[model samples]
Target: MADTTGTVEASQPGRYSVPGPPPRPRSQLVGTGFAIAAGAMAVAGALGHYMARRHASGIDPGHDWLAGQSVPNPQLVYALITLLVSVVTAHWAVWASGRGERGHTWVGMALTLVMGLAFFNMVMFSLNRMEFEIGSGEWATLAFAVTGLSLAILIVGMFYLGLMTLRSLGGSVGRDRSTPLGAAVFFWDFAVLAWAATWYVVYVVK
Candidate 1:
């Protein structure tokens, strides 16, 4: 009496639906959101630090203490680098998520958490020492702290994504894992280098 013909055909094996790849995972949204938030914070911190330094030195907007040197405006440069790293890490998270993987590797996550905390401590200690010596006001000190914290978050996210990419390279995790892994390695290592340079130049030398 009813439309039983359609129901009968739907019951047939491989008749109602065509075989296809599984739906892609959505866990990457978490990492991407984190990366973007960290980037926003990083930009704010960078501006704060730059302004504080400029104010301390009584330098006009167009001038810098290292005007004679080729690599002037260290704070702004560091901010730009952090922003770039954030973007790359976010992209990696999206790519990995699209592969239908459930989530990130635990080892990578642990490593990133540890390194990020350590890096944050180093940055804060160095900046605080400078603040103490220079007797900077509360606002300037706050700015430095903000910059350090933001960069720390960025580093953790980036490191996690980088290590994940590296892990994928060991096996056939993805078709082009190597490419992303290379980028991860570069950015992760660059962060370390940048930290060391910043410590020496900003805290020790300057």
Candidate 2:
């Protein structure tokens, strides 16, 4: 009977064995990723068209692109800085949620929300103070269109963040339930990047 006891125990149906690692939690992250990619492509296309128009119509001698329209550079700079800070807060929220730090997560989300609102206000102020009307000319129209698209995207991201924040309040944002928070952060970060590009092209390049 060479190792009969070991063979008998191994053959038992209910005998215990070393457990493997826990299964990874399922999430909607993949779907969110696809959506973010599509939104980014749309923004890129709009920016590309705007740049092409600027080069063709604004660059030639005696053909001013802005047509003497004044862009509020100071306000735009503030808005970009606000958005960059929001990026940090948004990531902070995700990080805290992953570690089950509910208080820190709430603080991070709240700060990000406040920064986002401030940025929106600054953008609106800049637009209101601008001398050029949206219907002024081709250049004016394209510029407004690009900036307006960025605002719309930012609004969507804010909406996502709001919903996730509400979910967090209901105790749905811990280590095992952080997927929604992560998705919101991803979209908000995308919004920030889109606005950064828009700021660079429309404000800096002009």
- The candidate scoring highest on lDDT is 2
RMSD of each candidate?
Answer: 10.0, 4.5
> In model 2, how large is the Cα lDDT of residue 27?
54
Model 1 worst lDDT run, 10 consecutive residues: 62-71
TM-score of 1: 0.37
> In model 2, which regions exceed 4 Å deviation?
1-27, 58-63
Cα TM-score of candidate 2: 0.86
- Candidate 1 local lDDT, 110-189, one digit each (tens): 44444455545544554444434222443345445544654664466466555655566455244333344434433454
As a whole number from 0 to 100, the lDDT of residue 18 in candidate 2 is: 71
Instruction: Report every candidate's CA lDDT.
Output: 0.47, 0.86
Task: Indicate the worst ten consecutive residues by lDDT in candidate 2.
Answer: 6-15
Error of 1 at 116 (Å): 12
